[model samples]
Target: MNPAGDPFLEACSKTFEDQFSPLEVAGIGSFGIVFSATTKSKSHIDKLGTPQHRDASEGSGTQALQAVKLCLPGCPSGIKGSTSRLQAEIEAMRRVSKNTTPSVRHLFAELYAFNTSNEPWYSMEFILPGVTLQQVFDVASAASYPFPEEIVFHVADQAARAFQYLHDQCRFVCTDISQSNMMLRYPGKEVSVMPDLVLIDWSFWAEASDQTTTCAVRNLYNCLAPVFFDAGWRCSRRHDRDSCAASGVFHSC
Candidate 1:
């Protein structure tokens, strides 16, 4: 589907016209379309309060860029459920922001603002000068350059810590842990050889539980833990860890 022509995008453009402008389609997914946009004025941002990891003084003079995820007119579920899901995603991020260790806090995006009342959507910190882990792997393959071992370990270590926080503090399990969902951010003016890893896309995350929880097994089959394949397996912390391990091994090869 043409994202630009999508009626939801048009509606969002009209609804948030004054607050945000230049909505460029960044990515499209089953549930929604993500737009990279700049807030027209700082007042709108100020209303949402200061973001967790960003300097309050950084965007005082200029428009600040943000990633906005707008739900499809009728999403994976209907409008009501979709709005609830988006709100839940924002809440999950907020929980991480509040409880996560300072060093690992940057690994998760900060929630800026959201509106579930009308034209359900939420805006978040846009990871500038960043590329998905999948994109990094593709570039390495194209250049016939061996993917660096240190980079793999770097990503693995950071991801492990993030997962531990989610499991221990939040009692959440990120069911979908894959290369495409992992982003590498180059923080400084000059692109660094070793970039920081940031995990994104919490749409499919589930609360950790000892009781068996039904998951989208088809979507998770490849990277899922071996126990998940059993007829009645319970969700646990190992689910994310195993998936992260499998993803690291599969992509780094």
Candidate 2:
């Protein structure tokens, strides 16, 4: 808990009704506030949701708890229009989810409700118990940990599989495949990490099926597909290849 008169928390809390409290500022940018919450809705019985850990005896004990996410448009500084972008993202998720497989949580924009009557806002599922691979990498990198081939391969494999689905099946080229966009739905259960990884954030993507044009530029060291440097070149499946071998670090925003 913060101080009683914490203006930041108070301002954020006022954004939502009394039911859902702002648990924490998950991600803060010029866009808006991303909060993890516990809802006050009745009949919220605890059902056997997705498992995050696997039972040791059965060699499976990585089942995680459940959670909810609230996306508020506009940050404290009011630099960007989160409301409009939120709508676009939700619409994109809806269209993509219909064709995506259950294993790939690519289209997980399950909107619980919205409050457009007054101001625009976004409320959706809160995938819990599991964390993002970005978080895992942060911990390892912060400790100056060296990567084992198995771990690197495992993470890359999971991401690559999701990317394949997004490109091949969904026919969408996700220009932003950073660690922050990769979320874990269920952890150590019977589900393999390969498919459990949910690729999120389509703000910098191009949906070839829809023929949408994207002017977003992404040249980050980590998720930089070769075509990012091709100025004015549209995002397509052909650019995802790694044309050169470069050794460095990748960071997620």
Q: Using TM-score as the measure, which candidate wins? A: 1
Q: Which number leads on lDDT? A: 1
Clash totals for all candidate models: 0, 15
Q: What tens-digit string does per-residue lDDT give for candidate 1 at 1-253?
A: 2336766567657767887764577776656667776677666566655362234325455556677787766555655666677777777877787787766766876675667666556545554447876776566556666545555456556666677678779887777767677778865212256767787777667887653122322333333222122223233455665556445433233
- Estimate the TM-score of every prediction: 0.70, 0.60
Candidate 2 per-residue lDDT, tens place, 115-182, comes to 43445355454454456656755665566555444334344445555555665776666655565766
Per the 3 Å backbone cut-off, how many clashing residue pairs does candidate 2 have? 15
So what's the TM-score on candidate 1?
0.70
Cα-lDDT of candidate 2? 0.46
After superposing candidate 2, which stretches have Cα over 4 Å from the reference?
A: 2-8, 42-80, 106-112, 115-117, 142-144, 184-196, 209-221, 224-253
RMSD of each: 8.5, 8.7
